[model samples]
Target chain A: MLKHLTAAIALLATPLAAQDFSEGSQARSWNLYAEIPAKFEAKVVDLVCEFTGDCPADCGAGKRQMGLLRTADDVLILAMKNSQPAFTGAAVELQPYCNQVITVDGLMLDDPDLGARNVYLVQSIVPPGETDKIKANTWTKVWAKEHPEAKGKGPWFRRDPSIKEIIATEGYLGLGLEIDEAFIAENF
Target chain B: MRHFTLSLLAGLALSSPGLAAEGTRIQVSGEIIDTWCYYSGVMGGPDAVVGSAHHTCALWCSAGGIPVGLLAEDGTVYMVLKVGDDTQTAGGDTLLRMAAHTVEADGMLYERDGLRYIVVSDVVSDLDITNKNHEDYGNVPGFSIPDPNK
Candidate 1:
């Protein structure tokens, strides 16, 4: 009976030991699609600086790409998707904390393509003293409200003559359309 | 003899880094879309292409230095990048000008993490834009059609 109890205790203790030693094992177990509450404390670095030694003064002034360098794991997490429209969401919130060690709390997103690279969509961010707040899509919303005339009128080349001229001379291909080579050869 | 020849051909195709490194030249048909609006469903859903309806918004986004993407016919979105000699450059003014139009792009194809990318070398407008698969945003709220009578 004593031997049986010892065997059972050993089995229970083995899993506990493994759990404690395995780094990020619990964090990695979260479902990729689920909204996982995540907090990353790291230095904000511009992705462009990784290749070109040109680290911007203010993380590209929120006009260029930015990412988070998780010092704990030595992984660079690309924090923003695009720089156009002055950026939105986490990109905007993290702009002020550029090159500084800050703690950000948000829902971790598993980008299908960049999943292995630890890319996440930040929902909210917090600096040293502040509490967490939702990251708003401010730029896009403002643009949508301001440009009422822009509604439903798209493929701007058809409406604007100046745009057409730009496309013709500058060789700006409209959208990603597969052109018929035969037709091009015959027409122009 | 036939089996041996097939094996040799397979080996050459697999082992040739030069062929893979340079990438395969392909001409793909698709709609040029702004990545942000398309993925986040901000302007519309994922099917939203840069069309006459969404041209203004797309132009605004593209002009602001957004990375352009090609939504191909086969349902693959290629993150369009510039083809440079040594390194890939950001999509420049040319991409902004082409914001939302059905176009055919000729370029080198690359795949990473199940996502496709085309380093655009050349592009042409598909004159028959109506035939392409584009999500139509028909006269949504806050947009007015121009008066041809005026």
Candidate 2:
């Protein structure tokens, strides 16, 4: 009887042990510049829908916002971040997996501006029962074909006329607060 | 016994290095602006403008779940984070209501990667309640003149 009670007690303690392990592992993975490669099998969800339970048809397409409802803890949502300009990185790859359960491989980025929110910069996504298919960043190709004049011209923002106007009037120094000038000058 | 073990684990997690508070309580006075517009310089001009003119747009963007940031008088932009216990109420809720108005907020400030975040506890608007803009008075002919009889 004592042995059985010991076994039962150990079974009850298992979850707590697992939780502690996860917390420690996650804490160690919180470096900003370091890209911690991670794999997660989760449901692709729109943040608005996941939080409000009001799923939209296009899944907030123009916003390019998507998150992963981690299978291990459904309550925890890993918001995906775009690594490229014009929301063309993970946003483009995760577009096909909306509202579907899929496996995603990515680098976890700790974004200070987002407060406690951590971003998953997705590298590739695989549908259930399918082999891993590398993400080729097809959106970049499409963007290049559409804007042939933009080739080697610099980042999209540099080529943007509206941004050019702001730069011309404000100078790059005027983009932030006047106080930020010293910091910007030192950094950039 | 199970409950005790779980509680202990929770305590340890909360007291962990990254989760523990290395900051002190601070009072910051600033204008609440939507972070997207402030950082991206897209919709609004790059310089953080706080006035009645920008209030409507700031409220709209903040209400749409954009992160609200406080551009303090000291020129520090603080990303308002929800207080630990108050998960339901976003930090933007109060900021949205007081958009474009100067407010003094009491909060615990945490810093990481040259960015600052404040988990606000209290907010007090600096704008006078009785002060009315000319637009609020509407078009009135010769209303500027005081009554001579009084």
Candidate 3:
């Protein structure tokens, strides 16, 4: 009886200890530049659409894009260029996140033409500096305000990336805002 | 109403063309007989140069004389002077109508249909809102407003 009780106690205490460990570690600290209260964080996303024409069923020609901002810890700019496969009739999209950062794990189709290796897992860490810039820069703010559906409540919130499957993987395409290879090699 | 203001402005133009500001100014200058929309050639691009892209231009008349379009030295076509918004009322003297003119207007100078023409910048109705003009309005012909020193 004591052995069973001890096992149950260990199992229950494991999650609590893990939670305590996360709170004590530096990994738990994150800043997702939002207008929320100081104790709470908000989510900001940027959706970009490129006006690529039609393509084959397997290609990512006519598809929308979605990106999110994870908390402040990791500054990852994840771009899901194609929300739906080719022939979906959706427009090519480009989303830029200014004041928010996000972490996501899913399938990302890589394109060699642009020299970028799309990723299934991306984590963006938007700093406080970027948030201030977005607020002050009238051009960036105007674009964000015009497209409320991209940030507001829409089908985008429910469209989750299927992390269970890996469709295809390749090298980075060297697209828009990406990590510098030289900087990564020197630092990471 | 427009005639009264324009005549008053034209009288000012011939009297005080000398008191106009120096750097990139939008003023009406000329002697008593010839009135022209005056602007200076700014060097830098819109982003680099200050007050390089902003200016206000307008046509004026004392009586019923139609305004003429202002032609550049190369005859490349410059200001299309018109009374009010209608071009037919203009005196074919594209120089008399008022519009915002840019100096380095290479962006708008495109070879379309085998003809070369440069488009001026946006037209501003209220120059007083800007604070860049430093000349006293009492001496200058026409009403010249300064740019905002923000």
DockQ of each: 0.04, 0.03, 0.01
Candidates 1 and 3 compared: the better one by TM-score is 1
Residue by residue across A1-188, what tens digits does model 3's lDDT show?
99999999988766421221112111211121110111112233222111112112222221222223324422222332122211011111222332233222222222232112212112122233453211111222332354454454323212112100110111011111132233224332
The true-versus-predicted C-alpha distance at residue B131 of model 2, in Å, is 28
Residue B97 of model 1, lDDT score: 56
Compare the candidates by TM-score and give the number of the best one: 1
Off by over 4 Å in 2: A1-34, A62-64, A82-89, A110-118, A136-152, A175-188, B1-150
Q: In order, what are the TM-scores of chain A for the candidates?
A: 0.50, 0.63, 0.20
Per-residue CA lDDT of model 2 for A1-188, tens digit only, reads 99999999988777521331122122223233434556667887654344334345555552334567677645343443333323333444565677778876656543344333334555566786797555625555554554576567554434434334433443332222342344334433
Which DockQ-derived CAPRI band holds candidate 2?
incorrect
DockQ of 2: 0.03
Q: What would you estimate as the lDDT of candidate 1? A: 0.49
**Residue-wise lDDT of candidate 3 within B76-96, one digit each (tens)?**
332221222222211123222
- What value of lDDT does candidate 2 attain over all alpha carbons? 0.48
Ranking by DockQ: 1, 2, 3
Q: What TM-score would each prediction reach against the true structure?
A: 0.47, 0.45, 0.16
Score residue B40 of candidate 2 by CA lDDT: 39
Question: What CAPRI grade goes to candidate 3?
Answer: incorrect
| lDDT score for residue A142 of model 2 | 51
Report the poorest 10 consecutive residues by lDDT, candidate 3 chain A: A163-172
